[model samples]
Target chain A: MTPTDLRAAFIADLTAVAPDLDPAAIGDNDHMQDDLGLDSMDFLNLVSALHKRFGLPIPEADYPRLATAALAVAYLDQALAE
Target chain B: MSIFTMPSLGADMEEGKLVEWLVKPGDDVKKGDIVAVVETQKGAIEIEIFEAGQIGALLAEPGQTLPVGAPLARLGVADEAEVTDPVAAPEPAIQASRAAALPAPAPAPAAKPVAAAAPGDAVLASPAARARAAELGIALEAVTGSGPGGAVLLSDIENHVSAGPQPAAQPVAEDRPKGKPGLDMTEMRRAIAAAMSRSKREIPHYYLMHEIDLQSAHDRLTALNADRTPDRRLLMGAFLLHATVKSLAKVPELNGRYDVEPYAPSGQVHCGMAVAMRGGGLIAPAILEAQSKDPDEIMAAMRDLVARTRSGRLRNSEITRGTITISALGENGVDALIGVIYPPQVALVGFGAPRVRPMVHDGTIQPRLAVTVSLAADHRVSDGRRGALFLTEIDRLLQEPAIP
Candidate 1:
């Protein structure tokens, strides 16, 4: 899948968890938790959604790689490639 | 026959609309089965039955607004011999056929066959399990039962779903009516107003605040969550909740309800976590038997409670069983909040946002992570001194964070 598709998937999952989130306003570098105000539970939901969507194994250690939109999309892109 | 009445979900809720029924006549239901969804001031709550029985008749219709304790349904004895008897058999069979014939009734059974089968051959499953099975398109007969007398439970269905092939990425959003447009905030505001008004009118409240150094708690939490996944990680709120529960044990007078003239202190702590809903409203459902749970368990329970509360799928006991409430301001919220006690309960504990501040630690002034802990207790049940001790115990507990 293209980076654009991965970014769209990320936004869709994020908005599902935090319904009030403004998707268009989200910057690529904005921290999902700190800047976007997703709590631990909400962040977990987002990760679970991504895992369900892409069918990738997101280990606990690699959670830091998905911290930001840019980082998450890049991580997904690389994980999908390999 | 026993009547399943509309339960008082909270002190604030006086009436609720019977939004939908999950069970029909002739269906076998057990204690703790969610038979109906009632739209209260707090939103759509899945109403659980308190007895094991066969659903005999639905006394109320969908969309009919009824007061608390009004009969919602009639439950007949689950005994086969009793149901087979000529006297007991005909009424429910007739009702069963009538209910089955109703347009768009859930669990749409073949009208004649279910009535004929009544209490004997009907699948023994909780309404929640049935609903989930219907959602996932899993046949209930295919799933093995794990509950009492081989009843197919929600967990059993969940296990079945997980063990089988993955279904399409259909969000479980359909399980809840997302069309309600944010849980009727006007009704919630009214509920809050009534409860707060009653609380202020009846309970003589005494407020106390203590600034606790959260340096130890913060460090411990960071260390704990470093190797853990997002799902397994603990929040500072859990630590605050744990400390509050432990402190409640020390000051027992502040731990229970004051419903009648005499104050009754409970031996157990059902700590109510005040969670703000997504659209706009607040509901504090208790973490049942919080005394036995560690910080990790408390965090899990809090997460589950928050999710269910936001989804408007809370059980009746969760709303009614709170002994004391704990309200924590969000990360970006103000420094402190003096909360109104959710009455019948005598006390409220508030945790403000933790911030770095210069404090006198050991000898010299140093920057420490600190939070303000506030308590609003009923003056009738306990004095300001006991409240102070409760706050002090919480401070001590937080300073020496529990290993778990």
Candidate 2:
């Protein structure tokens, strides 16, 4: 899948976590903490999900890159595009 | 909007004939405030709000057969001011009238009334059935539940042979006979059954025993009681509890369980005192935080536990959750004994009646209290030597018993 396709897939998968959530509202700029109500446990789970879905070594030290949905998509797009 | 559940009015009621909504769909509710009423086989009973959420929609109409826990009303506490009523509701009269018959209703009597507890009845019954039983002066013991969740049904009540209006059960009986009229196990007994069942079934128990010279303990208690008023004087049970706590501090191993499954970890060392009710069945009412609590606090907790055990109005939460137990049979005059390990508890200290036996204490034949301590344990969870060390620590503390 293309970088754009993978980013889209990630958002779609997250929406499935809580089906009641709206997809349109969860854009690139949406911070996961705000848009998805991701508490610490949920945030950690989100990281785990990202690792298993795409083999990307996003270490705990580099977690700040995942500041918002848009940044996460951008980072994943860059890595997958390479 | 979530609809709140309507409580069953009487035990005999299959479905409570909706009396009136104490609050409409939009009204707010605290945890325990009464919301609605349902008619059971007996009479109209009030139901209380369980979840601290908003009533979302009304599934059951004014008169509907709510098979116990079946959602009568939807509660939306997680989401506020979001009352979403379902467009299509289920049948009312047809469903209620065809309602499966449940056991008859029983309201607690004025004396030994159903613990006017804040709802939260025993499991295996519907909310409607539980409320109805509470109202009809009936105890849940007689009812049989048939709901998918094993909830007691109105039909169960109808089949139940009413034990009849039980005499008023009072916590403090009037006109006490000179000797304590062997109090029956009405309240404390039930608490023991529920609490012990939960603990034993869920926890892997280990036992610990230690024998100490009861002569010192007895003398100490006698002297203390002699100085104080008869009512406030010290009891042997109080002293044992005190020493038990002190000893537990030394052997932290006895303070918790060795849950090898990794799922089970170190358990807390709450002490359970095996209380023998006059009539029958033994109950081990626990002393919370026995290790940290002082002698006076332990004494008070023990008093409260014994009193409540006799009263039978004990909440289920209080009955269980002790990591260890200090079971004494000295009151009944038994010598040293070995008790069956209460599950999940690593050890039990069985103290029997102190005998007037000759002892070589520091190379002297002095009359000593040879109280036997039996340590019962579940071998799977604890090693015999570890269990023995726990008993040794208890013995050491009991012998010393410093006032703190």
Best by lDDT: 1
DockQ, cand. 2: 0.00
Instruction: Please give, for residues B1-404, the per-residue lDDT of candidate 2 as tens digits.
Output: 23344343212223334544454444456776667655332123346665676554445556444544344655556444353423323544424443454222122122222232222254466667666655653445435567776667766655554644322221343353221222333533443565457556665555555557777667766566455432344556667667766766655565554434542433355787776543346656467667667666776777666655543233222343566667766433557676655555566677776677787788889888677777776555557687677667766766664642
Q: Candidate 1 DockQ score?
A: 0.18
Model 1 lDDT, full chain set: 0.77
lDDT, candidate 1, B124-223, per-residue tens? 7888887776566454544668999789899998898788742212222224443234376677778999999999999899999999998988888877
If candidate 1 were superposed on the true structure by all CA atoms, what would the RMSD be? 13.7
RMSD of each: 13.7, 25.1
lDDT of 1 by residue, A1-82 (tens): 8999999999998887776677898999998767886665677778777878888767656878999999999999999999
User: Which lDDT value does model 2 have at B61?
Assistant: 59
- Those runs of model 2 whose alpha carbons end farther than 4 Å from true positions after fitting are A1-82, B1-210, B256-260, B263-267
DockQ of each: 0.18, 0.00
What lDDT, from 0 to 1, does candidate 2 have?
A: 0.55
